[model samples]
Target: MSIWEFANPRKFTALSLKILPTLVGLSAVLVLGGLIWGFAFTPNADKFESTVKIIYVHVPSALMAINGWLMMLVCSLIWLVRRHHVSALAARAAAPVGVVMTVIALFTGAVWGQPMWGTWWVWDPRLTSFLILFLFYLGYMALWAAIEDTETAADLTSILCLVGSVFALLSRYAVNFWNQGLHQGTSIPVATGGRTVADVYFLPLVVAMAGFFVLFVALVLARTVTLIRERRLAVLDAQEARA
Candidate 1:
């Protein structure tokens, strides 16, 4: 079947049930393995010492935060243009996950910064924009809760999400655009001759990123299924009430 076929609530629910278990299992395995390797196997950084271990979680979560917002933006666009209920539901499902990821990124960053930058927090460009992204997540979710009508809520929230897209983009490139902080440039990139982290450390970082992506997908799928069922039940209850 084509991709659009799964847009149906029943079809999506059935597919999610079949796939969620496998995703959950893999996510658990990879995350555990990554943590062990990152913390125990990798040698301490010459400068940052063992505290560099935080990169395993912090970097992945930061990447997810931006990607999650992008996912919501795309889903919101589809919802508005195609009037797809599933798209709107998916966007709603992703918001909480995105918010949590942002929190993880911010918390882990602060912990890492304490030793590296000699401060827990700073009003730097990248950090400041990331905080704004988190607030955007909160605002989007709150808007949905405040509006009683689902369609109206989706429409309004979609507009806000689109408008807030700049924050996500800015969060990533902020360091490049403005040099207002001590945050180092990309460590994984070769173009800048960044630090050549050992494979033992880098491998776990890869696994952790994969695990988080799978986990995010599983959560979004589970939440979307619940949303679809609730929406259906609401329609049925409304019909019965009218009758």
Candidate 2:
């Protein structure tokens, strides 16, 4: 069957419930297991020392923060073009998760930077763009919360998400665009087929990254299901009142 069949709320809910437990279990295993291995087993980098271990959280979170916005952008476009309620709700559900990821990334970056950069924060190109993306996530969620009309909220948030996508793109690419920034390059380079980091750090980091992505999917799926149910309950209440 076509993937779009999931656009139906009942089908989406059914599939989500069926897979959520597995996703949750897998995420916990990977995240917790990878982090423990990285912190306890991996050797400290000669340059950053023990502080480099924070990459397990910081890198994955930063990647997800950018990716989460891109996901919302895609969902928003789907809602705008297809007028699918599930798509809109999915975007709404993702905003909070995105914001939390942004916050974690920023906080961990600050903690990691203090010793390396000799400062907690800097207005570097990548950093600045990421901060802006964080603000956009806040605005997207605020726009949703402030509006009473669901369709209106969805429409306006979709526009906001579309506009905010520029920052998301910048957040991901700003390091490459502006090489002068203090932020280091990617640990794993896709195009180069080579990684800057060592094998010990690379394996755990990969596991952590996979864990973060799976965790993000689980959170968004759970949240979207709740939103769909809540919307259904609201409709039922309206119908009962009318009767």
In order of listing, the candidates' clash counts read 0, 0
Report model 2's TM-score to 2 decimal places: 0.98
Q: Which sections of candidate 2 miss by over 4 Å?
A: none
Put down candidate 2 lDDT per residue, 97-187, tens digits, no spaces.
9999999999999998999999999999999999999999999999999999999999999999999999999888888878878998886
- Which residue pairs show backbone clashes in model 1? none
Per-candidate Cα RMSD to the true structure, in Å, reads 1.8, 0.8
Highest TM-score: which candidate? Answer: 2
lDDT of 1 by residue, 144-222 (tens): 9999989999999999999888999998887776877877666777467565777767889999888889889989999
For each candidate, what TM-score against the reference? 0.94, 0.98
What C-alpha lDDT do the candidate models reach, one value each?
0.90, 0.94
| C-alpha lDDT (0 to 100) for residue 216 of candidate 2 | 97
